[model samples]
Target: MANPGYCVKNNIYETWKNWEAVNLEGMKEIGYALSGCNQRFLNFVVFEGEKVSVNNFYFIAHPYNLELPVLCRVFRIQPYNPEMELGRTGPLAGKKRRKADYGKKLEYIIGFAEILGYYDKGGKWRQMEVAPRPWDSVYEPTEDSLRQFLLCQQFAQNALVVEIGKVRGTSIPVYLDLNAIARTHTFVAGMTRSGKSSFIINLVRASSNLKPRPRFVIFDRRGEYGALMKYGAEVIPYTEFMPAITNPDVIVGKLELKRTEKEVVLSAVRMLIEEGESINREALYKKAEKVAETKASDKTRTKTLENIKWALDNKGAFIDREKKPLDIISQIRKTPITVVDYSVDTDIEAQQRTATHIINHIKDYAMAQRSKGDFACIIAVEEAQYLAPEKGAEVKESSAQGEAKAAFIEAISQAGGYNVGLIVMTQRPAYVAKSVISQCNSVVCFRLKSGNDQEAIMNYTEYGSERLAEYLPGLADHEAMLWGMAIPTPFPLIAEMDVKEYPQKAAAFAKQAWERMEEKVEG
Candidate 1:
């Protein structure tokens, strides 16, 4: 509720008549008597009109603020000059002019403020439809006046609320809507050691405990999520879940088979199905070799065979005779979190192939099961650059594997409406696919050192601008600027990850564990 009586004892800024932005002179000394408040660059300033009319002027509120979040960013500053000053014509002439105009610079500080929003009759802060009437008494919003801009009904409910950070001034905990993540997708960006992994872990822990817990499938590139296994996150080796070639699309799209080899794969799968045999690497390889002998040229045959052998060697035992194809969505349904660790997968391409396959399957499952209500999940892909590489780069989109990965990312981004959230985290934002980043509705940005990466964030994500970009490089570890639909308002926050919550690095208990080990060894 808006307390009109929550007044400030001191707010003495008065507007000048020549405040029209159209006229250069009119903008000069736009507001005068700028005194009293300890105003900063981004503070809320309310202009009080003579009569209290509905159109009198109210600004929209930032969802984060508990009261009114109408804030103006102080962009530029200049001297307040009411009239053109000609150098004192003469000492006597200066005295005759007036004491106020004689031998004095302007007393008022002139600065331009971008009107953010104002409070409406319902006490809800709304965005300003038009510029406020100029020459009114401009007063800095009192702290109490600013508190009424709490999150609206759209955010306060149906949100997976967790303490992400604290509001700038008060100890009030700031929360994010995890539901928004599935609805619009999220981007977690930072440089190395900028707490990107920590943030992910924190998020996983939070989401794991939600009322109707959302499934989390993390693509653990560097095995960072091994610590999160205690949170019911099953850490499966990449080899254990090498995608079976159940779908012909997997062979060409994910495995990156050549145009010629695609036919060999199709023939192989057909042969296996005819024999009522499960799709396995050995069967597929044998069929490819058989096809190579007749249809493929000697050069093409050798390369095709070599590619098949390389995949089998690198991706290890994808064909389980009895076991069904590894369904990531099924695992997610049973467990809150599933981490597919690629630490053992030395070949980068092999890792990409596996990830591409998993993402595709999950997206398909989520979209198909959208009406089921129980099929909600979030896939947090670490080292997302590899999965969704920028076009024409080292991992060009033209490449078979790259296209598959890009396609999967595109699908997940597009399938947000189907309750499938893609949380992409990367150290190098510049390399991540532009389409993927652009699709993200929420952005949790840690420190970014590279100008290219910073520029990418500004270009792709929401509320990203020069002002926000300026803070990226200087953010402390664990601190980030949280923006987008997930949070009520975009603000800098220190993500809290209690040591107990991340028991993976239980350093305090290491000594006790060592003692137990010594006792067991003696026994």
Candidate 2:
């Protein structure tokens, strides 16, 4: 007996003819369901003259059932030729068969798809309880039908939605739930130059345009996001916006002060606060010298004074002596987008301290805002691996860096209650803290070349199967797989990111600078 999975030749021809007669204009009869159908997977064989590609969406319809059609995505395709396979191993093992013998008569295409469930009457995707029977007709849905099934129309005009890109090959706009992203946090990871940064820039622009816009505090490590100033963003240098010291012990911990030195520094900070003096580098150094003179021996005082002076001189990127500290809370409240440009500061330890300090302040402020009504803000951290490195990784991290990582992880875990969101973007997910990535409810992944990095992403998302990881290294630029609460469905979808034009490229700026230097030489 013939296999039950395949339809008879005549039956397939008749099915195609009947489908055409029905005049379903855009819907095309492409194939028939085959034997391996199940609740989670569908196997089908394509008819002659029809084509299907990986990642394409198709619908399977039952002959007698009137339920909504099941939507599935093609992930694998192979050529099927049972006769040719047998002929090669049978009598024709040594003899070469003429190409004209079989022609295309025995050739067929097989497709393996993952069932993406079907949209219910209310337009929500639900799991499939039953699989389509063998020989059932498979259809390539029209663009309109696919869009409607994906619920693209509902979010098109919604103000709270932010359009990141389109469904990979279609014009259907893919939107993310802004509220969900802000409250639950998001993780965006990819290799360098894989369009992760561009996606974030677009997100910032979209979020800024919304009414009662949530504040955006972007820690721009590479100084790239300054172009957002054209979109009404306030780009401030890191040195100008450092926060004042609130706790002496915290500062001492950040400085990694020695046992004897820690007391002198702590006493100095306390004296500065008590005497109503601004705790800048010079004032702190002066107060520390006085404390060392009063409590230490000559040998101890010399070492203590030298340590304090060195710390003030070298690790003072976030310290200010004369000028009043900028009110960061007021700045975040007033500006729609605040970019803290850290490109100029090369002190890694100071950067960590600054990040930790600012995060603590934001957390406190966010809590107060949430008490009144709906208030939201996003803290987008670029190059997050440096600030939130995994504990005891290859690179030895400082105590201050550990504090920064802790603060970020804490913020991510408790952000929903405070309405403060965290967007952690990194080129090296392997180096970043797993806790930070795991807490984020949404993820946008671009091409990742490292197996370790791919494995890191796999730990957090449900779609991170071995087969799915195989696709990560090959994803094109500007294309990303989006999943989790921010998206419309639980099944991940690849998006072609839509980024707005910004200022001149970095290369152009460098060329301009070289030309200026040449002119100076000529003069």
lDDT of 1 by residue, 434-478 (tens): 888999988888889899999999888876666555457766677
lDDT of 2 by residue, 146-188 (tens): 7656652232122256677899899987877776777778899
Query: TM-score of model 1 relative to the true fold?
Result: 0.65
Question: lDDT score, residue 429, model 2?
Answer: 90
**Which residue segments of model 2 deviate by more than 4 Å?**
1-26, 62-66, 80-107, 121-124, 152-159, 245-320, 394-397, 462-467, 502-505, 508-523
- Candidate with top lDDT is 2
Which candidate has the top score in TM-score? Answer: 2
Question: How many residue pairs in model 1 have overlapping backbones?
Answer: 22
lDDT of each: 0.61, 0.75
RMSD of candidate 1 to true structure, Å = 12.0
Candidate 1 lDDT score relative to the true structure: 0.61
